[model samples]
Target chain A: MDLPGIVHRAGGALLGTLQHVRIPGVGQASVTDDPATSARRWRAVTVLRDQAAVGTPEAPPPPLDRFGDRIEVRLTAAPADRGTELAARFRGTPSEAEIGELRAALREAKQLLEVGEVLRVDPQPHGQRKPTPQGAALEGMTEQAPKEGVL
Target chain B: MKAATWTGVNEVSVEDVPEPTILNDHDVILKIRQSVTCGSDLHLIGGYIPFMRAGDVIGHEFLGEVVEVGKEVRDRKVGDRVVVAPFAACGSCWYCKQELYSLCDNGNANPGITEGLWGQGVGGCFGYSHAMGGYAGSHAELMRVPYADVGTFVVPEGVSDTRALFASDAASTGWMGADLAGTEPGDVVAVWGAGGVGQMAARAAMLLGAEQVVVIDRVPERLTQVRTHVGAEAVDYTTTDVVAELRERTGGRGPDVCIEAVGMEAHAPGTPGIYDQVKQQLRLQTDRPTAVREAITACRKGGTVFTLGVFAAMVDKFPLGAAMNKGLTLRGAQVHAQRYIPELLRRMEADELVTEHLATHVMPLGEAPEGYRMFKEKDDGCVRAVFLP
Candidate 1:
C-alpha cells in the first residue's frame, strides 16, 4: 500500500479505537469487552415492525440472509410497540471486517423493513477535495463511519 | 450546479458541484428558492465543528420548489413549493413516532462519528457536516431532501416564500424551546439572544400566552427588531445587568422561563467573557457557555431553562450547582422542524410570525462568500444573508 493509503487506514483505525477510550466528561462510557467477547455478543437493531413481519431467523431479510449459517440471527419483539429486535452474531469468532459487515447488514435490514428502502448519501454533491492529510483522515473516518459505532 | 461550500476555516467559496439526485425512495429534489445563513452554520464555517470537510455544502434553512420526487414519495410531487425540516427523519422511527424527529434512529447514515462523540447517533441534518449525514445543503440551485413526506411542508398559498422560509428551522427551533420549556400564560420569559432564533422564540413565547417576553442581546438592530417586529421588550445585555434586570422586571422572582439561543461561540462583556474566550482559544473548552451559564443563573426557582442554540460539545463552569439548588429544569435539542413546521406556516399565513425582517441581506448564490462574510462578522446589520439559488 502507498503512504497516503496507510495514513488513511490509520485514521480509520483511530476512529475504531475512539469508542473504547474512557473520558469522564468528554466521551461516553467505554466499551470494555475483550475483542473476542465483543465479536461474540449480539448486535441488534430495533425495526419498527412486528416480529412475524421482520421474517424468521431461519429466513431473515436479504442482506442479513446473505450471512446464512455463518451467523446466528434472532427475531424478538421490542417493548412498548417500538418494533422487533433483529439481532445477529457470528457462530464463530469473526474478524473485525466480518463484524463490520454484520453491523452494516443489520442497519440495512432495519431500514429496509421500516422505511422500505435504505438511505444513500454518497455521490450526492460536493466540490474539490484538496489532497491534505487532514482531509484524507476525515474521509477515512467517514468511509469507516457506517461500519463503526455503539451499535 | 453552483453551490456555496466551506473551502476552509472562515472561508466560503462558490463551486460547480454536481447537482444532487434522489438517493432514497422517499427523497425529493428541490430547486432552491431562498436558503438563508443560520447562526449555527457559523460554527462549521469557523471550524468549531471540526467535522466539516473542505468543499462541503453548508446551508440548512431554506424554501424551495420540488422539481422531482422519488417513486415512494407521498403527499408531495413536482411543482410543489415547500419548506423542509433540517433533519432527515424517517417518519417510522421510534423517536419520530414520539414527535422527537431530530433523534430519529435511521436518519444519519454515518452514525459512528456522532455515536463516538455523543454516545448516541442523532438524526441527519442537511449540509451541516459529515458527522450529521453529509447531505448537500440548500445553498445550491438544486438539492435532495430525504424523507420528503416527513420533513418537507407545503407552503400555504397566501404565505410569501420569505415568510415560510424561517418555518424550516429558526421558527421551528424557537417554538420548540418556548413550548418545551413550558412557557405558561402570565409567565415572564427571557430569551438570551436576538438572532433569528432568539427573535422567533420571543414571538413564540408571546403567542403561547407569556405575559411579558424580553429578548436580550447586545446587537442594537437585533434588539430593535425584538421590540419592533417581535413585539417583545428588548434588553441590551452590554449596558444592563441581565440577571438584575430580569429580577427587577419580574418583581424579584426572575423569569419563569429562560431560553439561551446563543451557541458555543457566545460573546460576553468584561472579565468573564475574556476568560471564556482565552480558555476556548487555548483549547481548554470546546464551547463558550457564557449565555447558557447566565440562563441557568437567571432562571427563577423551579423555572425551566431551555437552550435553543446549537452547542457541539462540553463547556466549562456550566453552573450545575445553581441549577440543582434552584430546582431548575434544563433541556436542549436540535430543531425538530417536522413537529412544528405546519403550525408555524399557519401562523406565517396569519402574519403573526414575521420573519421577512430577519432576512436583512439577500443576494444570489454567486455572492455567498461575501454574504457569509457579512453574516460571520455581523456586518451591515446582516441578520441572515438569504441566498437565492
Candidate 2:
C-alpha cells in the first residue's frame, strides 16, 4: 500500500481504539451526526466525572497530519448532576465518518447515564434566515411562506 | 391548516399552514378544539422576544383532541381530549424529575440560539419564539406534540372546554406564583393586573387559604370581575394611589405577599411610565417593570414578592434597596406546568377554581388577527379572546 494510505489506515485504527476504550465513570454513548458532518467529519465524546475534577484532565491539541485530521476536547459542568462532564470531538479522514459516528454514540451514552435521556431539538442545520422587521410582517401574511417546526 | 402566525410587531394573521404530523416515537398530533390569547403572547407579537421569526405560529394555551399518536407514546391515545402545557419537557431530564419542567435540559429544539441569548437554554415552548424551541403553537388546525405522555393531561369528562383551557397556561402559572410565594392562611396577598393571569393568581391565593386577596389594575371592568367573579377586593390604580391604598388596606403594613402578573409592558400612569416608554423606544431597556416596582414598594417588610410576569430582558431602576432593606424574599419563574397542572385540574373538578369568567370573548379561529388587536388593546372588556377552531 502507498505511504499515505498506510498513515490513513493507522490513524483510523487509533481513532477506533479511542472510541471503545471506556474510562471508569465515563461510558460509551450513542452516535449521531454533527450538523457540520457534511463539511468536516466531527465526532464528540461525553464523559461523566467528579464535578470538581471535570476539567482537570488537560486536553491535548488536535493531532495534525497530512490528511487534515483534527480533534478537539471540551468540558462542561452538568447543572443538576453536580458533576463534571467532558466532551471530545475529532475530525479526520479514511473512516472519519465512522469515527464521528462512534464519538456521537459516546456522547449519547454519557447523557443517558447522567441525565437518563437523549436531549433532542429540531435540527435547524441551515441556520436562521435573518428577517427584516417589515419584510417578516409581510411574509407572515403571505400564504406561501415557509413553515418552521419546533423539533 | 389555518394557523394564527406572527407577521410582525403587533401583527398576526390566520394563514394557511401545513398540517403537523407525528415526527417522533413519543409524538402525537392533536386537532385543536380551543385556543386562547395569553398575555405572554403580547410580548411575542410586540417584538419583545427577538427569537421570533416572521412566519412562526403563535398561541400556546390550547385544548385539543388527540387524532394520532406515535409508536412510543404509551399513555395517550387517539380521540382523547387533552390540554397541553405551554412548554415541552423531556420527563427523564434532571430538572423534569425535580418537577421543573420549564427548565428541562433537553427540550429546546433550538438550543443554540437560546444558549447564546441566556448563557444557557431552557425547555421548548409552543408558539413561543425560536429561543424557547420553535415548536409550532396550538392556534391551528393541528399541532405535533413531542413527548406527549409527559406534557399533556387528559381533560376530565365534566370540565367544559372553556374552563379546561385556562389550565393550560394562565391558571397553572398563577397557581405556581402563589405556590412560590408560600401563601398561607390569614396572609394578605395582593396581585397586580386583572388580566387572565392576574385574576387566576388572585383566585389561587384565595384557594391557598389567604385571609384576603386584592387585585389591582387600571380597567374598571377587570376590577369588577375581580370583586364579583374571583371574590377578591379590587383596586383601580388610575383612580387611586396604589401603594398608599395597599398600605391602608393591609392595616398600614402592606400585603404579606405581592404578586406581579403584569410583565415587561407595564404602564405607570405618570412620569415613571413615560420614562420607561422613552427608554424602551431608544433600546435602553427592554422591560418597564412598573408593576414589579410597585409590588416591591407595596410589599410588607420581610414579605415575599412573587414575580409571575414574563420579563424578557433588563429593566432600569429596580428598587433593590426596598427588597434588601425590607428583608423581602423575591422569587420568580416560568410556570412549571407539569408540576401543578394535575392539582389545578383537581381543584377545577371540585368547582373550587372557576376559570370561565377569564374567557370573556370567544370567536372563530379565522378572526384571530382581529382577536389579537382587541386583546392587545384590551377593548370592550376583553380579558382573553378564545379561538374556537
Candidate 3:
C-alpha cells in the first residue's frame, strides 16, 4: 500500500536514506526520497507498515501500523535536519531537547494508538512484594478480586 | 520539597524529593493544599500491588491549587482550585469517548506491565505503581498533572475541601459501583465493607433510589458510621452469620444487589477465613476472596454483584457454579472519576452527600508515615487520613 503524504514526510525526516526491505513479522519497510527537502541532507522517508494493515485508509490512520493487532514499533532513523523543520511546521517550534524527545513521544503515540496506552516502567525496579505468609494471604483478600486462572 | 515516598514493604517515609515540573504541553502543575491517604494506598505500601519502586511518591486522592499550566493547557489556569482524580485519562481515546475513563486507551504511560498482568492495560493512576503508570503521585507540595483539561475538575464554591477530597477516589468509586450494580427503585442493596468506599456506596445506593441499603462490616465504628451517617442498616458480620442474616433481612431471598467495597486484604472471621489464609499464604492463590465469595453466595437469585475494591491479580475458590446456577451477574471496575466528579460535586454542594465524617484523622504531611500506620492497623478508629502540606 502507498503511504500517505504526512507519513511520507515523517518517515523521510525520521529515517535517513530509506530503502525497500522486508523484515519477518514486521512487514515492509519502503524508503522514498522527500521532494520537499534537499537530497544532500539525506532527506528520505521510510514507511514500515505492518502486515496487519488492511489497505483501507482510516480517517486519520494510526501513527504506526499495527503488528498482528497488538505490537507496533517504528524501526528506522530520520534525519535531524528535517526533523526540526517538521516539528515547527506541526507542533510549533520546539527546542533541540524537545526535538530529541519527539522521537520517543512519537513512538509512545504509536503504541497508544495501536495498543490503547504506552508501556511504563519504574525508574528503579524494586523487586516483587514481600512474600510473607500473612502478606500473601492478604494479597488474595480483595473486594474486586481478579478473576480466576490469571496470574 | 518534602513528600511521602515508599521505601519498602510496610515502610514509608517523608523525605526531600525534587519538585515536579510541566513535562508535556497539556500538563499542569498544582500546589497541593490537601492530600489524603486512601484505603488503596494500604495495598501499595503493604506491597500487595507490585510495581512500586524505591522512593516512589505514593498518594492519589488530593485537592490543590493550579500554580502553573503548560503552553497547550486550555481550560485550567493559575489560581484555580481543583480536585484531581487518581486515574489519568486522555479525553480523546475510545474508552474516554465511551465514558469509561478508567479504561482510557491512551492514558497509561506503562501499559505493557498491566497488559501482561490483566490481558489488557487499564488507565494510568497517580501515585499508583508503575504497573498502573509510574506517574509521580499527589502526596507532595508540587506535582504535575497530565491531560489536565479532562482529569482535573474545578471544585465549585460551597463544597468544602473535606467533602471534595473524597470525590477523587472513594466517592467516585462507590458511586460507580452503585451505578454498575443498577440500583433502582424498590431494590435492596447490601454493601460489604464500610470504609470510605463502602460508606459512599451505601449512600449512593440510597441516592439512586434503593428501597433498603444494608452495610456489612466487622469494625464497630465503620458499622456505626454506615448506620448513623449513611442512614443504612448496619450488620456486624463478626457477631452474626452474614449469609443467613442477609437472607433473613431480605425476606428469605438475598438482597437484589451486593457490592464488595473491601478489596484484596479482606479479613475472614472463622474456619473459611483460615482456609483462604492458608491457601493464599502457600502461594496457591493471588486473591483471598472472602468478601467476593460471600457476595456471590449471599446475592439473591438473578441479582447483581458489584466489586468496587482494587484487585491486582488471580484468586482461588471463585464459586462460578453458584453464579451460573443462580443466574447472577458480576461487575467490577476501577473508578472512572472524570465521568462522575461533576455530579458528585453537585451533590456535595447541595449537602446531599456527607463525606466530612469519613476524614477521621487529619494530620500534617510530615506525619504521613504515622497516619499510614494508624490507618493500616485501623488504630483508634481511623477511617481515613487527610494530609495537609
TM-score, first chain, each model: 0.95, 0.29, 0.25
Candidate 2 ranges beyond 4 A from true positions: A1-151
What CAPRI class is candidate 1? medium
For residues B1-389, could you state the per-residue lDDT of candidate 1 as single tens digits?
99999998898999999889888789899999999999999999998998888999989999999999999998999999999999999999788999999999889989888888888889899999999988889999999999999999999999999989999998999999999999999999999999999999999999999999999999998998998999999999999999999999999999999999999999999999999999989988999999999999899999999988898888998899999999999999999889999999988999888999999999999999999999888898889999998
Please write out the lDDT profile of model 3 over residues A76-95, one tens digit for every residue.
33243211111111223333
Once fitted onto the true fold, the runs of candidate 1 whose alpha carbons sit more than 4 angstroms away are none
Better of 2 and 3 by TM-score: 2
The fraction of reference interface contacts (C-alpha pairs within 8 A across chains A and B) present in each candidate is 0.78, 0.06, 0.03
Backbone clashes, each candidate = 0, 12, 20
Which sections of candidate 3 miss by over 4 Å? A1-151
In the range A5-46, model 2's lDDT, one tens digit per residue, is: 444344334322322334421113212334455324332332
Whole-model lDDT values for every prediction: 0.92, 0.75, 0.74
Give the CA lDDT, 0 to 100, for residue B271 in model 2.
94
Error of 2 at A137 (Å): 15
